[model samples]
Target: MITFYDFICPPPQATKSGNTWKTRLSLNYKGLPYKTEIIEYAEIAQLYKKNGIPPAIVFPNGYAHHTLPVIKDDITGHDVFVVDSLEIAKYLDKTYPDSPRLIPDVEDVDAQIQEFQNQLNGAVIAALPVMFKASVPHISENSQAFYKAARVRDLNFIFPDKPISSLDDLQFTPEEIHATWASLEQGFDGLSERFGGKNTFRWALGDHITYADLILAGLLLCVKAVHGEDSPQWQGFMTWSDGKWKTFLDNLGPYLSEDN
Candidate 1:
């Protein structure tokens, strides 16, 4: 059995973190049996420390940043905790060689996929303001306070043109929001073109699914989960780039289950 740690959000928007979703998708893709352990935003570090799981990253200031998408694997006959989605996927693949590989075994394939993910994530930045705004109401007050403080301390540069002392300050004008969405759509279009045009390929690397596909799907699922399938944000996204994203996500439907 595997204990997958994910962050918690209020009803109507449960499981909104894209980083965690990446691991969930990977686990499901490999047919791994796991249960979710939902942690609040402020409790991540404490829980990790208690379980002897190390932080995902550490800053120069010595602050250890513990994050979700961590998995405690019991199938290996011992408690092996893997932090970070990418690391968890790699761990799963290494431990369960019989399962389909998420990170391809080909030489340089993993590096290529990582580069693709990096570029793809750059495109997602434009949409962050809107996505963050939509997520505010669904977060608990305590978590909200925690995130607001963390943003001010570590992510004040997100809005360099203006000061962001509070989460509300992250908001953008209606025009800016529209432009951001348009920019994201263009990014998706460019990604599709790189892989042989829109709707031409079912997965990131031709027919077989890989970590690259999960990376993209994780972001899309986060949007869908946070904004709701009926919201204009999701509706517009589904139709973007001649419905390429919609088709791509649909192809991943079998692995989209939330087996909590």
Candidate 2:
């Protein structure tokens, strides 16, 4: 069985990291027999150090800190260490050819999935504050301090000065929140067109659970982690966009794998 090293929050109910979820999605999608090892915030560097995941001069690169999802596959005799969610997915699909594929074979379809992954990442960054605020409390106190500082840096990029020292101190008007979500909407460019006209996509690729679907679902799951299943954030987003976002989330009901 593959040993999937993933992140954990305070009660450890769900794997909060979107990247971790992506790896988990591929693992489950392939029906791989993998067990999880929960790694805390401070332990990320330790994981790399112990596993000897040395920095590489390779194209995809390696160990750029904050590396949370690392997998160890011992089934192939010697241990094989893999990091980064996308690479992990590609590796799993390539190694286990008999299983369902996360990445499709067609070049154009694969390109579309890659495009959606980029968009989902952009959306997550634009809506970072909301995700961090909801997630901060569940982290270790030590990690909470670091997470807040890091989020403040990220928030400053857009918010400018007036650093947010705490989640409680973070303030955004309803209009401001709407604007952030508006930015996130841009990340979904061609997605909504599939359902009807505006803000409607039944799936990342109509009816198929591709890597794009996993990535998109992972982005929303980050938000869901902050506020639970029926979060007000989801409701507010739906209200702002004529229930488009809510419908998208609802459509992804089946692919909700919680743990790492």
Candidate 3:
């Protein structure tokens, strides 16, 4: 069995991180048997270091950030640790060639799909202020402190026009919220056009599903998880781009199971 590492969010929110969801959805799609090991946000770095797992990301300032969606696979009769969602997906595809490939063997296909995922991620980041605000109430105090500090530290880059020193700065004005939503909508529209426009295809690569489609679904799931299905934000999102995203997610229902 594979050991999947994921973040532990409090009640009312299930599997909050899109990065983790990418791996989770990939595992489910490939019919892999795995057990989840939930870790708190504050414990990530320590846990990784204690286990001698290398950092998943190293920032320009030399900060080694250890992230989740990590996996320990022993099916090949050798223990191997894979970090990062994309890497995990590629690893799974290479290890279990008999399963449906998430990262196809076609030439340059993986690069193209990664670019598509990057575009979708831009939209998700644009809507972070609102999503993060909604999530604050549901996370633990330790996570709240950790996230707040990290956001505040990176405020200049994310919100250069409105520098902030605290999480209270996220109390966005009505105009600010409207502007962010507009940016997110525009981002979605651009992505939709790239894949033959809204309602044109069931998946990113026509009839077949790939990591690209999973990338889109994971980000959409993040919004639903944070805003709740009944929230106005989520309700409005379901109708955006001619209901393209909603239909896409619905088609992926079989692979969206929460159970491992």
Top candidate on TM-score is: 1
The TM-score measured for candidate 2 stands at 0.77
Report the lDDT tens digits of candidate 2 across residue range 51-123.
7895322323331445657789987898998887777888898889999888778758767866766655655
**Candidate 2, residue 131: how far the Cα is off, in Å:** 3.2
Give the clashing residue pairs of candidate 3, or none: none
For residues 68-89, could you state the per-residue lDDT of candidate 3 as single tens digits?
A: 8789988879778899888898
RMSD of each: 1.9, 4.3, 2.1
Candidate 3 differs from the real structure by a C-alpha RMSD in angstroms, to one decimal, of 2.1
lDDT of each: 0.81, 0.69, 0.81
TM-score list, all predictions? 0.92, 0.77, 0.90
lDDT of 3 at 17: 81
Model 3 per-residue lDDT at 243: 79
